[model samples]
Target: MSDQQKRLQMALDAAHMSIWDSRIVDGQVIDGTVSWSARGAALLGLEEKALTQAFRDFLACVHADDRARVLDVLQDGVQRHGGYDIQYRVIWPDGSEHWLAARAQVFTGASGQPERTLGIIWDITERTRQEIMIAERKELAEVTLSSIGDAVITTDPHGKTRYLNRMAEQLTGWTSQLAQGLDIWDTMPLADEQTGATLEHVAVKCLHQRQTIGTSAHTNLVTRDGRQVAIEDSAAPIWSRDGEILGAVVVFRDVSHERKLSQQLSWQATHDHLTGLINRRHFEQLVAGALHTAKEQGHVHALLYLDLDQFKIINDTCGHSAGDLLLQLLAKLLQSQMRDSDILARLGGDELGVLLPHCPMEHARQVGEQLRQSIRDFHFAWDSRSYELGVSIGMVEINQDSKSLSELLIAADQACYLAKEQGRNRIHVYQEADVMLAQRRGEMLWIARLKEAFEQQYFRLYAMPIVHLREGLESHDEVLLRIRNSKGDLILPGAFIPAAERYDMMISIDRWVIRAVCAHIQSVRDSLAPVEALVEQRRRAPALYSINLSGMSLADSGLQDYITEQFVQYAIAPEQVCFEITETAVIANLPKAQVFMHHLKALGCRFSLDDFGAGFSSFGYLKALPVDYLKIDGVFVRDIATNAINRAMVKAINEVGHVMGLKTVAEYVEDEATLAIIRELGVDYAQGHAVGNLRPLVAGLD
Candidate 1:
């Protein structure tokens, strides 16, 4: 080849192209007149000698599926005296299908008649394979997008909608055809569910930020027909292979049911289901907020604790259903009497709390009275019964002086209790002095009742068995004191002991108990059968009686002499009586207690340090006291089975008592679990309901 021809041939060879030429006659390619370069022959899988071939022969090499279209293109080019470019599949001699692209022009002579055609051909099987794969993937992606359940919308980088899936059409109430090319915000309008304010499109944010953006939980989509649909969605920017911003894809779904359920649970958590009012827990939060405002802004507020009177009577006369109806009616009445700013809540079981913000104490009292009157006037009718209800309200001002939420509530409750005590259907304002005055009044009442019991001889003695843990060890009874009211009801000492102690009557009560106990023991000794007397004499010791003494009695100089007189008068064995003194009493009157205990010890009377571990200084005071037994405080023994710290405390006390040569007793052993634990801890004696039920000392002796 010449130099220019060689360069042209080299360029075609570098491009992997082959040149071909053919003569055209009468608007058709001449048969047996087609020729091509060796590369073209090789691309067709033909021998070198096959470079020149008839037009029909070359057509034979074209794939059967593409041959007709190729021939039509060639014929049309020749007739139109124009050029054509086309791609067609070719089957090589090896039975492998390949792709080729050919371009040719129909050259015209001076007379404007078609003369010849020339073309360049190249193998495009690899590029064609890639294009096919890309088409298939695109088809698959379209199918997948249409099939998914979540509403999907694709937007251009400019935030204009490009495509919408089937779900998107249903959710937005807009067809894909109409949504195309529209702004994404217009197609999928959103607003805040709570505020009804327009929400910025997440797709726009994703496009701007070039990252994923999620819509808030409160977002609601405004459909085409102006209906709102709760939705949760996310938008992610689509990036091109070169990392350029292509568009964004938004995926969302309906969350109406979930949102509804969440709201219901939230409401139930803060509200009382029975009355539809806020519960105590939520009420406290609001009161705390009010308290904060009062302290910070110098604003005055008031809290009212209302307890419904006669509610229990109605509940007991009727069923709980009637009680519930009464409560519901009362709640409405109370709500109606309060201002819009006032918050009312059900503080559990016929009790309601009211919080009035920015109100003075006087105004709060008036409001409380109004609520009380409203409840008093409201008659509730249930199941053919009409009953009048009354409310006792306690009011406390919340101001800079307010200490804490809990203290305010407690003060209000105390005031309410005082109102009920004075008379029902009244409102009482809380004052610091109210608590002390109320306590005094209650103590006075208890004192009067105690004096009546003393004059009437209503005092009674009960005993609980204190059983020895080990076999063959003697068991004894701890004497407990009770009082009989004029109504013939038994009353435990707890109801009156504190008052008796505060008023200096505990010593009198103790003296009475000592004498009564001695007389009872003597009577029991007299009543004993001959066989029982013989058995008692044969035993190691007589039946022992443990008695409790007040701290005041312990300090009385003449108490020991009185006790000795009782013992001698009854001809009772001094060894049979044991005196129980609390840890606090001994600590309070250590010197006097020691002298009295030493005097009693000389007379063969035993002493036990009751409620030993309660003072938390048992070991310290135990060494100084003359005691035979250490009573583990019921506080620790009550939960010794489940509380690790209590168990450890009891164990330590028992071990220390054992080491000090004093027998250890576990008190308040109410259950098998507690009894088992103390037994396992090696307590010497167990006393409580678990060992034996409390019974009248006389009956027990008999």
Candidate 2:
């Protein structure tokens, strides 16, 4: 080779390039006239001797996918009389593919036609591979952003929108194409969910702060179509590798359904399902607030407690569904007659409460009368039958005199009871002089005190000895319940039993007594001796004890299970205990009482018909009851020695009880004379001060 050719080859080799020379005529390469440097031949995986082939042979080395394009570019360059740069793939002898870039210039003859071409060719496979990888990654990111459920938007550091995904387009109603150059605040308008005021864009904050920014709670998105949607959103700044802020990405999701459901749940919590009125719990909260205002701000308010009269008749005659419908209708009627400021609530079954804020006593009375009149005029129809309904309303003033919410409610309830007692369809205002109302209020107070007694274990058992009049029978004790007041003063059962019975709390009290008595007896028996003594006592006969059960307890379905559980828990034998139920209780619910007595009797426990002959003194009920003893009423026994009629009554009861294969016990044997009379009358037992004064059963056991 010449020195000049060698120098040129050296420079091309240093640049990792190759040189080519070809002869072209009329925009076409001539055959057998193409030549290339050794480096160019080496790029095609061939030796320099391979260049002896024609131009068509060299063209054959180009990849099949790129051969036609390479020919077109060469022809265009020859016709234009200018240089062309082209990139194409080539296949080596081993069938491996590589990218090649070529730059060529066309030389023209005197006739102004292309003659020869000179080009530099180099391999670009690595650069091409890197570019393909980067493009694939970018396409994958786009697809991922478009497919996600949450809306995604990207903005420049200046807070200008750059891209929006498919979800963003759907949520904001602005496509990426249209929002590309707009401000992010305009592209995604936001507002306060509650106030309906426009909110600043979170992306703006993210850009300024260069950190993640979360939207305030309860934010709404104002769409392009002017629709508001509840949304939760967060924006985070995008940072370059060198720690410079490049842009921000905002992610958001629609929460409209969640917000609506939350609101619905809140509504349901405070409303009564049957009447669509505020429930008692929420109403009491409002009344409590009013009471606070009355004390602090001297605001006058009034409360009305209304109970539907003869509602039980409707419920029993037409079924509870009809009663429910009637209540719903009455609620709407009462609401229509009240002012917007007044709140009405369903206190409980067939009962409602109304709060009149900023109203005087006279106005409250007028409102109550109006409500009562409306109820009286209303008629409820069911299944082709119509019935007229009436309301008894009680009004109480709320002022500085109102001490508490509970007291106010109790006062109103008492007044309502007074209204019903006097006559139905009437309005009664609460006053301190209402004796009946006072008694009822006292009973209500007893309910609270009784509940507290149970919680604090204030109730204690006391027993009075029942002396056995017949021979060979051991004396037993009759258990009585007494309560300890807050001041540690003992209260007799007479003070609280009536209240408990009236409020349907007798079953709870009876259960408490049963559990306490069983525990006491088991503890006493256990303490008297160890396992051997207990076994000996069981072998002989366990000491008998009597516990009083109220009328309500007989009707309680769970009471039997409760008593059985207590007996098992304390390990007390059924034969060691006797249950005493009043004659009134047995007669009031004869079937339930019979079932209760029979169940316990079958379990080896004895039953006594207490206060016998006090109610329905006839002997007919004696045949039906499965009782082992009849405790003659204290009234009859208290005067048996002096009163002939009382003596005759006790004689008749004892004789009849004996005839029915039952024993007769006499109560209120306060003197020897009464005791002597009962003994003469063949009474099997006597109980009262004459037998023994009351003493703590627990103390005796201890």
Candidate 3:
């Protein structure tokens, strides 16, 4: 090849240029596949032989949608000697599609008319596909913005409104066409909801800083038609591939409903559903806060605990609905009688708590008297019956000397009990010094008796037989602790148990009980050891003994180990001894009680949750406590024979206990009629004075 020809070939190769020469008068191809044509044809998945028929074949290969357009361009270039640039799709024999950019210029005759066209074509499919995809993604983004719930607006780097979705138009009261070219600040103006002051321009800030900017918490969007809404919005800048801020986009939503719902939920959490008074949980929180303030800032607050006298009689005589009505009426009356600064709460059941902040002792006592008199004067008429009510108020001055809320509450409760005992419808102030409060002298005397009893072994263990109500069920006996007064007269546990539990002496009493019971059980088991066959014959079933433990003992970390050691020393089977605790006790010290019960139960000892369905009993705790029996509280069983409500309560307790795979025990079964009702209710065991009077455990042993 000549140097000139080789240089031309090199230039074509450098530019990747393809040349085509055709006679457009008859559409004849003069030369095909000359400069880079071989390589271009190869890239198109076509052979060089096809170049000979390139004019007809290539024109036919042009995508059908672009064929006529390509023909028109060629006709204008050939006839008027005009230049043309066009991009069209090409299809190979395998049905593969490609894009080609074609440029042509016509060669003119002497008369200045075009005769033939010369064109260069090259494949540009990859770049064309990329551009198409970008357009498609932009279309998708527009559709998503218009379809979503949130309002969207886009702006340019200078904060000019570029686009608005459908939601944005509805919120701003401006159509996309009218909002275009307007400054974004003018299109979307937000102000503080409370202050009515215009907020910072979020779009301008986002665009200038190339970062996202959030609206203030109370941002209220102001619209064209003077409409406003609570909106939480943010603006983020649009960045180009070179990391330049090109524009900004703002997204926002109306959060008015969410804010209202959140406020409603907050209120419900603090107030009682029925009485509309602050619930116990929220009241306790207030007390804790007040305690802290009083200690830190030397503020004085007084707490008053009031109980409706004979509330159970009224509730039992009337239905629960009547009881509720009485409580509501009483709540309203007390609310009216108190000052606005005072806080009142329904601390569950018939108990109400009052907090008087920054009040002196004299004023607090006066307020307590007013509340008491108000309740005593109020007459509640439920159904056809008019019932008179009274209140027992306990007042305590909370100061820096108060150690904790729990202790203060207990002292107040005890003082309220003293008021009720001294005579109903009265108020009593709690005095820490023993001599001042003559009403509490009884409890102090009992404390002395308990000390004397524990020291002289004046405590005796008595067993009362638990008669099996079911025909073939086994029977057991519960051990009851009785104290002997200094005068040698026996005392019931109800008289002194309170005092023992009050001073945290129950843990020591519980240890003594465990030791005594285990010793008695060991002696019985050993007496019958020589004749194993006669052991079952001695009773309807093997004798199982139960002992009661106080709530304070449940909190003893070493109680379980102490029981285990007793079992080891006495050589007695844990199955022969069962521990009984009240539901209130378990609830008070749930973590420790749970650990104690589960540990001893693992060793084959049984547990009974006594006084079930008394107090604020939650069935939710039943699944957590593993007990062998549930003793129905005597309050329900005492009148079960005549009262339908009591019967239903007992029945429900039995059914739930059976469902949980535990036996049920009925207390206060004092007559044939009551025993018949409990037997029909499917109770597993019945224990009362009628079932068997308390007999000395050692004296009863043959």
Candidate 2 residue 304 C-alpha distance from true site, Å? 2.6
> For this target, which candidate reaches the highest lDDT against the unseen true structure?
1
- Give the TM-score comparing model 1 with the true structure, all chains together: 0.59
Q: Model 3, stretches more than 4 Å misplaced?
A: 1-22, 26-54, 72-85, 93-96, 105-115, 118-120, 140-238, 247-261, 284-303, 357-370, 395-422, 429-702
lDDT of 2: 0.85
Error of 2 at 593 (Å): 27
- The per-prediction tally of clashing pairs is 1, 0, 0
Task: Give the local distance difference test score of model 1.
Answer: 0.87
The regions of model 2 sitting more than 4 angstroms off are: 1-27, 30-61, 92-97, 109-113, 215-217, 400-411, 414-418, 421-424, 428-702
Which stretches of candidate 1 lie above 4 Å from their native place? 1-7, 20-34, 46-49, 52-68, 71-83, 93-95, 106-117, 241-243, 313-320, 436-702
Tens digits of per-residue lDDT for model 3, 526-604: 7765667474656465678999988888898888889899999998789888899988789999999998888999999
Clashing pairs in 1: 32-54
Count clashing residue pairs in model 1. 1
lDDT of 2 by residue, 388-427 (tens): 9888888898998788888888889888878887887899
| Preferred candidate (TM-score higher): 1 or 2 | 2
| RMSD of every prediction | 16.8, 21.7, 10.8
Instruction: Please give, for residues 544-633, the per-residue lDDT of candidate 1 as tens digits.
Output: 889999989988999988999999899989999999999999999999999999999999999999988866576888899889999998
For model 2, give the 10-residue run with minimal summed lDDT.
25-34
